[model samples]
Target chain A: MEEKEIISIWFIIGCLLFLFGVIIFAANVLDYYVPWSGTVTVLHEYRAGIWWGAFLIVIGLVYSIAFNPWKKTKEAA
Target chain B: MLGLIVPQLAMLFTGSNIISLGWVDSAIVILYFIFVLGIGFYLMKFTKTGEDFFMAGRSMTMWIAGLSFVAANLGSLELMGWAAASYQYGILATHWYWIGAVPAMLFLGLIMMPFYYISKTHSVPGYLKLRFGDGASMVSAVSFGFMTVLMSGINMYSMAIVMKVVLGWDIHFSIWVSSITVMLYVVLGGLLSAILNEVLQFMLIWLGALLIPILGMIEAGGWEKMVDRIHQNFPQGDYTHLWSTLGSFQDNPMGIHWTGIVFGLGFCISFAYWTTDFLVVQRVLTAKDLRAAKMAPIIGASFKMFVPLIVILPGLLGLAVIPGLVGETEAIATGGHSYNEVLPLMMARYLGPGLLGLGITALIAGFMSGMAGNVSAFATVWTYDIYRPIHRMFAKTDGTDAHFVKIGRWTTIIGVFVSIGTAYLVQQFASIMDYVQALFSFFVAPLFGTVILGMLWKRATKAGGYYGLLAGTVSSIGMWLWVKMDPTALKIIALSPYAKDMAENMYRALWSWSICVAVTVIVSLMTKAKPDSELDGLVRSCTVLPSEGHLPFYQRPVFFASIVFAVFLALNIIFW
Candidate 1:
């Protein structure tokens, strides 16, 4: 494919992902609530710790891959 | 034990007064300064040429470029500004992150990366000159310079306010302290020092920013208690519905009145930071090759996507915990206007001694990193674009390049002082965010018009470029004035309450940006293009070279990881 075509495809995919992400986030905001105890609950409050750990793991994976492109390229070469 | 011990530790470490601050805070502050200065000093070894000073000899690795891009763009203003917005606007402000930044960043990374890849110039203005002619380049360069100076002033002013209020230092004294330290390093080390210092500052800011939310969550009786408190305290609509509660489309903080937010996120913020800002562009320019520069912004933009968590989340958590805690009366009364204080207030309330001091130190580091970046960019531009041109024109009879470099160093010192002075003066007018935004909004549209259109539109001519800029500026200013002077006109224009303050003053500055592009295009269409020979170098910069065999296999994996991030962000918004 031509470079312009690749860029246009990526742009469309990115916009779709972003729009869908927002819709999902907005829906989550609407559903946030407390259990039967008649209190309020925050999504991040309960899940922050878990999310933090997961985020770090994901970051680590991305970091490793981005920094070690040479290994894959070497094999390709 | 967890709650009581943490508070006690915070009190011991991050006491209100400078002297009362713990040894660790003092130690970190002192050590960070020394480390930054040491980096600046070390970079002297590499500063043998003007290219090294301005662009690090154009040989930086992708990693270094990527980190510096994030560091330069993130700055202290972003740290405090986003936090404050979140504090005031509730969870809706997270729109900037979840809705605004993530998509824009990905667009920049995936779609626009190729453009930057092809554009092989050192400055964005150079690209405009390549695509159009000298006139377009000159206008862009000047507007960009003006915006940088204005932004620098805002960043310095905001930092000064924090230091003065939080540390009880005098404002003038804080300005001098911050300005001198940043100026000294930037003037000596130039781009090299700025990048190295930014890397260190980024690490500090990341740790410092994270500590506030984590510790605050623990203090508010863990996540469970925090949520309970928020629901109990705030009314139903405030915390839950992100966009609806902020009032009319005009008065609403989340309203579409600030189309600039879209323009900012989509075009100006990414394009300017990635393409224009020398502090950032210098990093990309320093890349080992074209591929590295192309990849660096993607990395940087990805890093930017995560910033809402670090900066904006704390503000959101603050809202969730203490709705209306920062009373609007106090927010407006003390020129402390806006929710900028959210992070600082949270720090004061939650973080204990050792961590608090470390956090404050990090805050200072963030401010200094931004200030240093601005000073370095200003100095480079003054020396290269302005002074160098004049010197070549006149001093060809006798003056030396070494003399110009010496003058550039002096210009940097003078520029920092001027920026600090501007910061002090600008504070008297408006909120930090408003002032910075207004200042940038004026220049961004015009500059973007010239660069984007000049490159993309083959029919664009020199006469069209000049006329387009003129029309954009005039129309925006005219609309702004109508909004300001005529109260009845406010209804017609749909002015926001925040914008109503300096009616004549506000709209002129605010709307000028949107008009710039249309004006530029219309004017360009009316004129004929110059010969292709004249446009040779202009378009060449936008040409992408064949990628060297440096394609990292890991990028494919990382691309998937970014997708996962998008999914996670989606889940957070949907479930909340």
Candidate 2:
């Protein structure tokens, strides 16, 4: 695979992982404030949800557009 | 909190609603599995060689290798074992985090990396083959190969037990799902996929576990209020102090003297694990350069210093918040769930459904990473050290490099299936599991003793290495059996009312290591030593010393190790 292609694939995977974290975090927010009495446990108030979600999103963004990782691979090549 | 009064049990993960995950929670977990599997499949395009299969072709950056190194060490034991231990023993458990790990890790990074890196061996046993000879190599390899598979199986059983008790997931379901998932990634991308996934899991563990200490402090009003509550509750119990209670075995709840903690654990067990264990060292060996290899453990050590905060605090919080949690009647009635369930309980109470699902997935991720670490390491050791020799001596013609990779994958299949069987058998003969683990601990101290002498002393011989390891392992087992046979001996040793099981373990490691060193020195003097020219890069005087002297102050390992050591001292003094 080309170096460029590998970077792009990492970016897409990172984005998807970030999306998963975001969805989990959003579900928590809905549960916390929506006053829904559904038998589901929603961590709307949990700090870990937001922290992990934000961290994944940043990691995604870094992989998606960061020139540094690409440069490192180039150097190795 | 609508979850407040819906009680079957009011603690975290105390729900009876098995298989009732919300749509988002279900989707999140499904995506995690798919994404991980996808990485494995995708990376298979690149994994065509033995180098790729075993060591990721030694191209990993520090962040990738370092995170994987630490995450692989964080197993179900990290989640449940230490958490429960902290709940039972209090803050003194932090010793395992700091003095037990940091110094040993730094020693590996600073002193040991050049030899391991410069020799260019695929596994620790391969290094043994290079340094000692085929005899020592085969001994270490066979033992490591068998032990890893058993450890993987135990990892599976541990995960199953947690899921069964907490989420009511059946043991078979846990076993199959975990085994298949672990096998998929490992067989697909080999070491790289396993490691990348470990990095992800490491992040998840912190996200999942950090909440207990953070929120527990809030609930107890603050650290001071929490300490006050603990004092009021267990006034006679020395649970808050770290070293202050360690003046004597009778004085400490741990039934260990300060000397035992420092030497037996911090020196013997720590050195044996960090320096000799292939599971952890393999990650560093995959780094792109020598500097990255050295830096990997430093990064791991920095992160390790904070682990006790996540693992130990929840147990301490349990004392102040959870009613009758420490009582044995409650402990047994709940299926040993009181203390063991502390981390999950804290998660359930604090996290809602989405976060709860993620937390549980994080735990499963931790277990799978451990299983993957064991399986992958076992595959390498089996193929290179065990299978190759047997094939060469028997009917095997010379195989190509690809043939070895194929053998490795076959070993992975065999190893995983074997682990599944072992996991089931472990369920029946739980007592055997203790002996298997004891056997592993038996190897560590003696192995370290041999490795250290070989690296530093030019006169160490191959015969000495094998014989020393044999003697050390035998003595360790003999002492362990003696202690198990006579529990009264601990009382006589310490004259303490506390159970001296852990103390006995530490002292045994010290004794075993001492015996190994003594036997090796005596044996080496009697045997023919290898020529120094033959020991190039495997011994201190023969290898090029790392150029840390020319590097900037912050980049040097000594500078970082010193900082970590200083923090370690301050933490001990503060908690003293």
Clashes of each: 24, 8
The top-ranked prediction according to TM-score is 2
- Summarize candidate 2's per-residue lDDT along B247-322 as a digit string, tens digits: 8767767778898889989999998998999999998899889988888888888888888887888888877876
| Residue lDDT tens for model 1, B319-340 | 7665654443554454332344
Q: lDDT: which candidate is best?
A: 2
What's the i-RMS of each model?
A: 15.7, 4.3
Task: Report the C-alpha displacement of residue B217, candidate 1, in angstroms.
Answer: 3.2
Residue runs of model 2 more than 4 Å from their true location after superposition: A1-5, A8-13, A37-77, B1-20, B327-330, B333-337, B395-398, B489-499
**Total clashing pairs in model 1:** 24
Span of ten consecutive residues with least summed lDDT in model 2 chain B: B1-10
Q: Model 1, stretches more than 4 Å misplaced?
A: A1-77, B1-20, B75-77, B106-120, B219-228, B240-279, B331-340, B396-404, B424-437, B494-514, B531-544, B547-576
Q: How do the predictions measure up, each by TM-score?
A: 0.75, 0.91
Q: Evaluate residue A25 in candidate 1 and report its C-alpha lDDT on the 0 to 100 scale.
A: 31
